[model samples]
Target chain A: MSSQAFTGGHKASHQELPPEFQDQEESIKITGFWMFIVTDVLIFASLFATYAVFVNRIASGPTPAQVFQLNTALIETLILLTSSFTIGIAIWAMRQNRQRMVTWWLVLTVLLGMAFVSIELTEFAGDVAAGWGWHTSAFLSAFFLLVAAHGTHVTMGIIWAVALLFQLRRRGLTTVTRRKLYTFSLYWHFLDIMWVFIFTVVYLGGRLI
Target chain B: MHGGDEQHETAIEPGFDFISPRFEEPKFPMHQVWGYAASLVLTFAALWMTVNRIMSPSVLLGVVLAMAVGQAALQLGVFMHVRESRGPAWHLVPLGLAFAIGIGLVGMSAWIMLFKSGVS
Candidate 1:
């Protein structure tokens, strides 16, 4: 069973790990992705540190109370959360071998991700238009650095997802495609968790003081 | 023995023991649905508490940060399928350590940098 290709729909385990971890090499790749996530955690940790350290250093520029739009941040958070759930469903559908359902769920996740990024970009553009650029102060710089870094990751995830859709179409639900989708869901969920911290630390915490 | 949608254990192997990863896809995504609801609640509860100034500043920060941790746990457990693996779940070792170190870095950096306000 370890060497046999799974025709999934039952349980996924050592011998039936869906298509993603259906083999040793495939699961090892999955583990490598987790290691990548660990590194990402450290990267974000340092960025969070920078943001916290510089938050109070407004240096005669716009304070978070002035620049932070609670409404926009709330919208972005909600969108990302929903997208995370959708990607979970997408993977579930993949395991169930419901190809069409998987496709629909992935499409929904991508659209939601696009909406989240759009709102974030609009917020940034609004700030810049009002002369509250990242260059204005240490606080703004840290804020942009942390957030734009997350936004850039979201952008990359979107590209990865779009490319994955093409792969799914081309390769169908082979072990390769399933592994790719599984990893993409992990990446998507990781981004949502990062956004959770951002909302708590940057947006809500900004108004705490 | 040949049912289409029966719950099953691994028969391909002779031994079943603890610490071995198990996987199941239920008829409904109970974990995911509940996790989604819980996350939304945590997100808004934190937002409402902070927006209304329901607590002192320090306590509010602590509460929201704790909620953020809760959200992370939900994503890791429910969405990421962190426990579902083919091996001994070795990935959690590095990930757990990273969380400890990462949290320390964030906390220490904040504490040390606050002294700049005192200097100025």
Candidate 2:
């Protein structure tokens, strides 16, 4: 597979690179995205620390055992885990140059993400309606902030994937499009990993403790 | 056709072939399949542990934390292709630094908050 075959370029070496790493510029961009993920990891870590500190401070508010629903958390976990799997398959399809398959998998991923967000929002609404708002306690505040930040990221991911779908329809599987999709998959997977911790430390731990 | 084949053969310089192995694409999505299966198993295991009340709180936390770390590693290695950089992989240094800082931030915060001056 040479760049000449795909793009009719004179230089053959360009085609040798993968679609995501098609050149020095794209390669650097991928590395930079990795760094961005690292920063995001630290941000989540700080939030997790804050949550740990205030986890016991109920201040006459609802405890985690009272507010958290295992069934809802489990459903959200399954949806997100499925989305992560679909996004992986989407990237795999991208590497195989199957544009339609990639697009559909990404579409599935976005739908699953939307489901997760909807469920999360509903849970929050229930909490607030029950008068367990963030202002009620430090524990609730930290919990809301951590979970909402993740929800915000997933919302952004859905928007990004939809935009990429349009790009894929217009441009096909060019180097630029491929790199963007690849980075998007990385971001999605990172969020899934964060969710793993959130479920374990927040929901399950809260119930157990 | 023979001449074109010869040209194609010669176009790939000697040293370039050393890196050509990676260019060979796989026919199946085996890695993704395995990653998905492993992640599902880990998720269910943690859920079952918590749901069944199979262990004490401290033990359950340790087991769940280990599973969380394992799931993250699976995503990074199999799904994210964390090592599939195009160059010398300078990106890893910053990633390592970030993890260090993250652990320090979490641990130090807990220590600072948990340990306070005593006033009897």
Most accurate candidate by lDDT: 1
Task: Please give the range of 10 consecutive residues that has the lowest summed lDDT in model 1 chain B.
Answer: B1-10
**TM-score, cand. 2 vs. native:** 0.87
Residue A125, candidate 2: how far off, in angstroms? Answer: 0.4
CA shift of B79, model 1, Å: 0.4
What TM-score against the true fold does each predicted structure earn? Answer: 0.90, 0.87
Which runs of model 2 end up more than 4 angstroms from their true locations? Answer: A2-15, B1-25, B116-120
Task: Point to the candidate with the largest TM-score.
Answer: 1
Model 2, A114-195: lDDT tens digits are 9999999999999999999999999999999999999999999999999999999999998899999989999999999999
Query: Which regions of candidate 1 fall more than 4 Å away from where they truly are?
Result: A1-13, B1-20, B116-120
**Candidate 2, B102: how far from true, in Å?**
1.3
Docking class of 1: acceptable
Candidate 1, residues B14-59, lDDT tens digits: the string is: 3433335656576567889999999999999998999899879998
Identify the leading candidate in terms of DockQ. 1
lDDT of 1 by residue, A1-209 (tens): 22233334334434556656656677788999999999999999999999988898899898888989899999999999999999998887787777788888999999998999999999999999999999999999999999999999999999999998888888787888889899999999999999999999999988986
DockQ for every model comes to 0.41, 0.35
